[model samples]
Target: MTDTQEHTWGERYADSLMNTFGQPKLVLTRGAGAHVWDTDGKEYVDLLGGIAVNALGHAHPALVEAVTAQLGTLGHISNFFASEPQVRLAEKLLALLDAGPGKVFFTNSGAEANEAAFKLTRRTGRTHVVAAQGGFHGRTMGALALTSKEAYRAPFEPLPGDVTFVPYGDAEALAAAVTDRTAAILLEPMQGEAGVVTPPKGYLAAARTIADEHGALLWLDEIQTGLGRTGRWFAHHSAGVTPDIVTVAKGLAGGIPIGACIGVGESGTLLEPGNHGTTFGGNPVACAAALAVIGTIETDGLLEHVTALGQKLRDGLAADPRVTEVRGEGLLIGLDLAAEVSAAVTAGALAHGFIINNPTPHRIRLAPPLVLTQDDAEAFLTAWPAILDEAFEGQS
Candidate 1:
């Protein structure tokens, strides 16, 4: 591998692909477990886990085998027909939720899942939705409308309207914002894009009660926090609240591209026939891949592993004086630096053969694979101080 190998590929990517995500970080070639190799033959420990998508890490045998077997048998079928894997995956998700009698609408990504949930809210004859400030649902029109970022929403103005944004973790503000006309109250159990910000204790419960009082549906967007990412089947489970709707993706299929919008009890029936539809939503391969991920997590006891590893990582990260705060559960961790140097820290980590993310100027977020090894974690911790020193070298 040479500079030409990576540089030439970067040029080709710029020429052939849309510039939505800016320049490619690295021309990655292959991955195994929590490590990936670049086109330049450099190996990096993937601490970001494909932005929380690769729950089982790279090239997991279970996911690959499930997808290959399913595709070999029945790769795809139209929504007009059903598949066993699709039905079984839905049933498994509902059983894990334990919220009693729910129906699932599968999609190709989290944005589509949120889009389906948004439409479901409209079926209640109400247009207004109360969403939390600093909350991120997705980039699609409906989900973007619910999102509170002006930069993201300004460019896509005229997004579906009637969505109200209230301060997160503020139960009073949330209660005041909702009305009988409010169709739904959408929230993230833990705000991931907002630097893995967690709401106050009982905030979700408060929102649930508020939704009940207003006769509005409680919709929890677990796209980044669900499916054992937070060491629980769902992040809201910790709050002990049963939401009317839940949207999940990212790691649902361990990077197989699948999302689900689950509606509990009577809310499941709201999306009447033809209210919503998807072409590749319940493709057999994707469903089978998701089933395999769920199975692997259970069999491997990854939930406990994530919980313990998260605490270890958090404690080690917070040991540094430059780290102001650390927040998150399981593998979805976020830390704030003393200065606005998260970008420097990210680059520094990469230079040290590790991959991390800077969601904000001062915030570093880590959603590593559930299968991240203790040795890999210890390696990062041992290198943490040097990475920070390099990042803060020139800072005054």
Candidate 2:
């Protein structure tokens, strides 16, 4: 947009909207490929990729076509008459998991997906859910009960109950906490919000075995890590475990709001009719968008692309002494700084025409679009030390 249009947006945004996310960094006007332009015509290499939602990057033709065609033909039909795209998305997701005999319940966001799974666990004739500390489930009441962050939970108290917290990636603690009374053990294969922490080898297998021994369902939340973002359809697949329930969203629809809770084996049938219902959960447009995303991933071999690029990024970032550690697989990477300079780094990156996330004081996270190119990753690497220098320049 022109300068006048940009200023108008700044004024209007300040006048309206809540202060929940602080001041708008830039009024983004358009996006394409790995870049987005703000209203002021400044462009940024979107390393964070809208918190990992833009898997195919911005304005990919396949995604746009799928969404447009589906919207033109059939849009929101409610949940009474099932849409082809919705059914196809479920079938496609099941195929990706390679888990048999599963049923899916769709929602509009990751949290809602978790919300559906939370209630589904309750239907297993058990009310207890065991989750990991430093885990992020979601913000809604039911999902929030399973989330571990005190700050996010404290403000929304009196949440749905029967949740127990244990240390993440600790199988022994999970085994001890999950009794027969527990309906499910929910986990993120790689902790996204807690700086991309992956569990030790065999941790998920152990969790699966423990759940089996206790007759509790094993649930994997792949909201931030699914849809080929981590070089696999689900990050837990690397653990070689078949979880009874899996909740996915985020990149599922390549930015279209969509989420799903799928239960495998007999666990799929817990939620009976009238148990839960949503007016706009399985809308056609969202499902079509997801189908396009999946198709593009397969056709473009984006999974392999992510694996290669992620390693390049990790290797480059870890070469700096100030970067204490880099943890993650594929494009979902997180790094620890030598000092509590993550916030400064994030601000510095933005100023340098790049985008990243500071999930914790001493840690930075990057869930860039799986389609992030080698050139982009290399450019970031070239700028890495300088970014850190800028971040550290004025520190106390």
Query: Which one is best on TM-score?
Result: 1
List clashing residue pairs in candidate 2.
none
On the 0 to 100 scale, the lDDT of residue 56 in model 1 is 94
Compose the digit string of candidate 1's lDDT tens values, residues 1-396. Answer: 778767889999999999999998898989999999998889999999999999999999999899989989998888999999999999999999999999999999999999999999999999999998899988888889999999999998999959999999999999999999999999999999989999999899999999999899999999999999999999999999999999999999999999999999999999989788999999999999999999999999999999999999999999999999999999999999999999999999999999999999999999999999999999999999999998898585
User: Alpha-carbon error at 58 in model 2, in Å?
Assistant: 0.4
User: Each prediction's TM-score against the native?
Assistant: 0.99, 0.97
What's the true lDDT of residue 115 in model 1? 95
lDDT of each: 0.95, 0.91
